[model samples]
Target: MLRESHKDRIQEEIGNDEIVTGKGLNQEISLVRAEDTRWNSHLKTITSLISLFPEVKKVLEYVEDDGDNGASRLQASGLLSYFKTFEFVFYMHLMLTILGLTNSLSQALQRKDQDILEAVDLIRTTKAQLQMLRENGFDQVLEKCYSFCDKHEIVKLDMTEALNPCNSFSQFNKSSLLKLSKMYPRDFDDKERMILEHELDIYYHFVYNDVRFANLNGIADLARSMVATRKHLSYPLVYRLLKLTLVLPVATATVERCFSAMKLVKTNLRNRIGDDFLNAALICDIEKEAHAKVKTEDVIDRFQKMKTRRGQI
Candidate 1:
């Protein structure tokens, strides 16, 4: 009832030219609810909130003054008050910036194509952008926040206030490498495990000093570069580890894709699908690229070869 009222009010506002359309805002725009399962949903919610700020305030004000129940009026009043706070505005801009940076990478990871090299490249780019933002983006964010607060008539923070900076970075250590190696025990022998740390040290220094390895697009490029320069032979353990790292993302995406495929394969109409058939269907659905390559004639030939029929059709 409340949402319908709000929707009607928004339409009225639009008709009165109180809420301007264009620049991604339209009559169809509404408050998007964030889902806990998906990070991108929060992005959508924030974007909608920002775009519909004025209309939202108007709706809230109307509800606060003319709500049917005291509780609804009180809730609307509280939200209006909270919306005007400097902290809320500041965090909204901050999250918008952070999530905007990572949104592409998140989407890329979940793609059906699932390019491992491209995903790795995006991860690197996101990390680099985040590090750069950490070092230099505070003043920019602060300026935007101040601008937004001023535009919305919200109370702004003092520019004279000094803020402490936080900084941290992670490096792969021998212990961490050993732990990772233990997870793939079959991939590493006792000798390889013992010498892995040494290979890593040499590989790190070599790559750091070598211009050829610097600014490589992704792990795939790095692997190819190492092979091109015959450095993979020099650092076999590190190359193995790199190969292992590349496979992990694809494996995770495959599992996610399988679960997604299950919804399409075993719908309400096909709810009686057995486990065996469902599994086979999921495999075919998830690996559509591979499945598409198999010719119908080849399948027919293989099926015919599987059994000797009493009567040939």
Candidate 2:
């Protein structure tokens, strides 16, 4: 609702505007403050594997079998062995690493699949790994908050449930790949599309059936907001929907952090800063922990010496 609302407001505000967009806004910060970390956390698993397991090289050999269908990812139950090697990472990943995984897995419990059980066990073991590493792992842990999704936002079909429908539950064999070639127009051998189709269908069902989609609801809502309320500016209705559902207090933590750093750099002494100068301040602030980091004075000095540099340094 909020995102849809935002979209309307934005569109109204930018009647003829087209600014830079699509994941370019502090891309790293966006990942850090994501509304959903499932995809990123999955990538993080590789890091966890590299970090926690000293025996990662040994484990890689076991995870190296061509799957039943020759797909080469992981065979059914074949993933079990690899699952164990990094089993210790689960709880740590869950409690300490990926909260989105926890939520997704918990919801998967309804299916009663052995894989889900394994996943839960995996998370538990990861927690145990942390426990042994520390006296109380939970202390370092912040219970994963689905604060963004938990409120007004409605959840769509999750991964597994989405793929495995009730109709196809009885049969081991599933649907075909060629059905929606346009959507999955990629050169890939496979029924992967068939699997995806099931999941996507369920996701759409949840969106239309569950969320009561107010964004695409109509022009009346947009007219009311832009012309009547005149609240948020020309943001389109669709963008508004995405932002509202996704943006929780946690989602913009990176942005907030950047703002804090910006405030420190662009203080009264640096208040003569240009937009570009302020942007540089944010960049330097974030890279403080890394090598090749930018210096604060470099920016501060530039601003202090600006043509508008009338302020007392």
**TM-scores of all predicted structures:** 0.45, 0.20
Clashes of each: 0, 27
TM-score of 1: 0.45
The alpha-carbon RMSD values of the candidates against the true structure, listed in the order shown, are 15.3, 27.6
lDDT of each: 0.73, 0.39
Q: For model 1, state the Cα shift of residue 28 in Å.
A: 4.5
**Once model 2 is optimally superposed onto the true structure by TM-score, how far is the C-alpha of residue 68 displaced, in angstroms?**
67
lDDT string for model 1 (1-313, tens) is 4355557766787899898877766445678898644567879999988877877888889999999999999999999998987767866987888888878987887689988888889899988888777766766787888899888898665322211011111233455556556646789988889898777767766776777765655556777888999998998887787676444221123544676687788889999999999988987888789999999999888888888987653
Cα lDDT tens digits, model 2, 1-313, are 3234344444554565543445543121111222232334544554444232323333344445433345444453454453442222323333333333334443444355558567778658655544443443322232221221232132311212212323322211222212222222353225544454564445344434422333433323333433443422432322232222222212222544675577688788878889987786677677767625647777688878776755755
lDDT of 2 at 284: 62
Lowest lDDT 10-mer window, candidate 1? 160-169
